[model samples]
Target: MPNILNLQSLLGLAVIVGACWAVSENRRAFPWKLAIGAVLVQAALVLLVFGVPGSAVVLNAITGAVDGLATATRRGTQFIFGYLAGGEQPYVVQNQPALFVFAFEVLPLILVISALSALLWHWKILKWITRGFGLLFQRTMGLGGASALAVAANIFLGMIESPIVIRAYLDKLTRSEVFLMMVVGLATVAGSTMVAYATILGPVLPNAAGHVLVASIVSAPAGILLARIIIPETPGEGGAHADYDSDLKYDSAIDAIVKGTADGLMVVLNISAVLIVFVALVALVNVMLGGFWLFDGPVTVERVLGWLFAPVAWLIGVEWSEAGRAGWLLGVKLTLTEFVAFIELGNIPAGEMSERTRMLMTYAVCGFANIGSVGITVTGLSVLMPERRQMVLDMVWKALFAGFLATLMSAAVVGALPGAVFGT
Candidate 1:
């Protein structure tokens, strides 16, 4: 592992905040109180989940629960698809790793999780949880009810789907509030994707489910902090109270399952299509660049990305020695998608990177902030409120920057904490 007391990460925290300050729209109107509060709230959440007594037990239980759900998902997949989905095969396999196929085994988990999530939403279990967090955000961060609710829902519903909850208030939200929602949306992953990520990283990191979930939760406040810095709120610019009525309604439990399954199908197909195309494109580019060689390696896409983002990796407390690979993952995440980057991270040989670096990279790339997502978010919001399309376009690029930095900020916090906090 890297240094238990990573002092450099403390500097990183300052640098990240300074970078956000440098991009402030209203430098004079800096949200000093919000900045301090957001960071404090994030730290308190981390301590409550990891550092406090009995926290590890709870986290372990979450991990076990996630693993159990994955197992349950496999049973469904296997029953449906037979040996292709990791059921007993008639023929013996020589290679153990090759037995588990991503499309057949991993992607199906999204479908199961999505249906379950929809059911939970219909049952009001997820809503109350979202409301609790929303209220917390409203109280601590001084966010309006609509903005707070949107950010809280973004943790579970994802960027594109999150706006649906606030669709009624989109026109009412101020420019700053919309941008905050966008930044937070981009900075976090959805509940449906959480299990898939955990399954992918399971071999590489222990308690992978807990780590994935914590990364999303931890980054929420970081998103708030950076969004406020980039576009500080003007006085009397937002609705003080939100109705909290959801536009996402279901006729019944079965209706929710059917609708959620349809949504999950689209998600699974999109992911499958994107991965197929993106991975092939990367390979094609690598083949084209295969002849060129840098000082120690070939000038491939990963190497190029590593060169571009190595400094960011270092800033997040990865050692200089492992920063190149870490940077490559970050770049892949930004350019391609987090799914592609995570698959690459899982592909890396064990023991080549330190546990600290692996953990930091996991948190660093745990956001939906990527090139593809920018289009999805802008287009989705535009569809939700056609009148606000221009405004959405105007601030989206900046929100992307803030959102990406938000995830990095979470990694920085992780780095600054003691190694024992993660049981390392």
Candidate 2:
């Protein structure tokens, strides 16, 4: 029998869900039945992708695309590093290896991927895929068309940008619908950032891109589940009925590339800046905590967080020895942001974590679910729908929980699957 009594996992799920419920306006009317059904559906989908052979093949195809991207990124790194392995490696290359690989080589590749994604969207490739996935969510989850589109868009776009697809519907979206949209946005990842994260974790874990891609897809339903739990979809005034207009005219493919590349650059810069400030703050907290003359020595914020989340790490099938390390990563992600946690995870010494733990952590931490994103969601959504600004604020906490749970659900699914399914 599978070891499923991972208390830390269960507790982590509970903490997020409970936080949402505690703060939600409609907490009393949370749709427990619908929430349960959505979780079941997400679980079923995970099992299909990781346990069934045919679904595994399809998943592998998606993973293959990500791996190909990673390989391309590796080649780009080699170009910048001037063949480190082929000749006498420079001292900088030897001591601070992969630094340039991450900053110059891998990060820029995300812009290329973003441009490629825009081209695909312009050509209707991603539209069809998103539509098919949207239909499945609409039928199974019974979400409105706008909600479905938002959720589907998350598979390809970022939290702030995905809502643009349903921009016309933003002002009139029901409270529950808006909440769902926010949840999905936080739950999934933008295609452009996925490549960057893949590059970040790729050096540490094999098949990192594939695992992150799968994790985002698997988290979709989980987002729905937790959203409904915090604010049940009560039958009320119908959501806004608006059509998506893709009428922004670009001169040509090159024009699209230029525009998209500019946009991706801004995003990358914002991400880098936020990460630097937030990490410094965390370090400051650790320093302050270190001054406290506790029982024997000082305990930093990361250590305390690791202790708090260790049980969850264990529940997710991480080996006992590695649970503390994994828990610290989770703590960092939850309190600060995924980017910082991922960077820290990447910096961990090789062999400190087993492959399974590393893979599960990748899935677990792949989301925009931390405290910072709450502000981003509120500010971005409010700008799009000024009238619903209060609703956006109201749903912010729940959306955070939903997003966190979504990632956990993905990790749990991967943890339960056999390693062969992921080609590990």
> All candidates' TM-scores?
0.97, 0.85
What is the Cα root-mean-square deviation between model 2 and the actual structure? 3.6
Choose the strongest candidate by TM-score.
Answer: 1
lDDT tens readout by residue for model 2, 1-424: 3445344444445555566678666767876666667656766765675557676566557667777776675666566566552233555455455445345655666777877777777667777787778777887877777788788888888898788777867766787788888888888888898877777787788656666777788788888877777767777664445343433335677777787788788777877778779889988988878777555758888778888888777766677788888899989998888877888888876677777788888888999999888888888888888888887886688678778877877676566655665565
- Candidate 2 Cα errors over 4 Å, as ranges: 4-33, 54-64, 67-101, 239-251, 293-297, 315-321, 417-424
Per-residue CA lDDT of candidate 1, range 307-370, in tens?
9999888888889888899999999999889999888888887789888898998899999999
TM-score, candidate number 1: 0.97
lDDT comparing candidate 2 with the true structure = 0.74
lDDT for 421 (candidate 2): 58
Clashing pairs in 2: 6-315, 8-311, 8-312, 9-312
